[model samples]
Each structure stands twice: as structure tokens, then as C-alpha cells.
Target: MKAFLLVGFGGLAGSMCRYATSLLFTRAQSDFAWGTWIANVLGCLLIGLIYGLSEKFQWLTPEWRLFLTTGFCGGYTTFSAFAFENLKLLESGNYWTFSIYSVTSFAIGLLAVAAGVFLTKM
Candidate 1:
């Protein structure tokens, strides 16, 4: 319950940050979603930095880790979680699994979105 609360609070803040970013970086044209793209990239970078710092130093407590990584990053951009997981797989030398996971995740994720849209329309 406490962990959940921490995550929820962090998520709330992260969501607000994402919204603010979207407002600040409004795209002049619809060809690209700069706001979302920047959010994901920044989220990934932040999570990576936190992970690295935690690994190098034992400063961050479990609650802080949960709040920052799970709550904030999850809310900010789930792609960061995916990116971090992929990075871990690569670091651990699981090349084949990493390759498979990367390819299938993107390909099937796109397909899933298409399927969802089609199903919703029909």
C-alpha cells in the first residue's frame, strides 16, 4: 500500500510533466510528434541515469527507486521501461533474446495497434 502510494504520487507528477512538455513543444505540423518523442527520450535517459547511479552508489532507497523508476518513468513514458529492459538484456549478453524481443515488440506492437483500430471500427 505504501509503495503503491509512492508510485501513484510520482506518477501524478510525471504525468503533469509530460502534459507540460506537450504544451511547450507543440508541433507546428502534424508530420511529427516532437513532444511525445522528447518525453520518451528524456524519460529513457533519466531512468538510465538513475539506474546507473543506483548501481554505482547505494544512495537510492527501494521506495525512491519504485517512485522514480516505476512511477515516474512509467507515467512519463512506458517506452523508457522497454528501452531500459532492452539495455539490460544487451548488457547481460542475451543478444538473441534481445534481438527477438526488440523486433517482435515493435512489429507486433504496431500490428496490435492496427488490429485494435480495425476491431474498434468494425
Candidate 2:
């Protein structure tokens, strides 16, 4: 029950933050789904940091790990949105944009995670 509450609260906070980020990107008036991309990449980076710190420094308890990684990061990252956006782009015949978005999101997201873990070492 305690664990559930922690994760729930973390998810609530993460969801709200994600929404705010989306709104900020919406104001940019760009066709690309910058909000979703940034959110996912950031989420990955955060999770990496959390895991790395927890492992290296033994800083986070299991409960904290659950809250931050499973709850917060899971809520913040939007794989569904990514998939839907790709579908829309494909349907609209934006192959080039779709390719670039999909490829870069994957590549950069991985790099972001690596970078986060690397930062912990420094």
C-alpha cells in the first residue's frame, strides 16, 4: 500500500510535468512532435541517472527506485504518442520526417541514457 501510494504520487507529478512540456512545445507551432520526443528522451535520461546513482552510491531505496523509474519515468515517457505520431506522419505521406523522427528519437534516446549514466561517473 505504501509503495503503491509512492508510485501513484510520482506518476501524478510526472504526468502533470509531461503535460506542461507538451503545452510549451505546442506554442512553438511546429509540425514535429517535439514535446513527445523530448519527454521520452528526458525520461530515459532520468531513469539512467536514477539507476546509476542507486547502483553506484546506494542512494535510492527500492521504494524510491520504483517511484522514480517505474512510476515517474513510465508516466512521463509516451511510446504510445510516438507510435501514433509516426502513424499520422506515414498516413500523411511525410516519409522523410517520419524516418528522421523515428530514427533520431531512438538513437538520441539511447545516447541520452548513456550520457546520464556517464554523468554519474563524473
Top TM-score hit: 1
| Candidate 1 Cα misplacement greater than 4 A, ranges | none
Can you tell me which runs of candidate 2 are displaced by over 4 Å? 78-122
lDDT of each: 0.94, 0.81
lDDT tens per residue, model 2, 1-122 = 99899878888888998998788765466788888778877776677678778989999989998888777876787563466468679989999999999999999999999999999999
**Model 1: residue 94 alpha-carbon error in angstroms:** 0.7
Clashes of each: 0, 0
Global Cα lDDT for candidate 1: 0.94
**Top-scoring candidate (lDDT):** 1
Q: Which 10-residue span in candidate 2 carries the lowest summed lDDT?
A: 78-87
Candidate 1: tens digits of C-alpha lDDT, residues 14-108: 99999998888878877789899999999999999999999899889999999999999888988999999999999999999999999999999
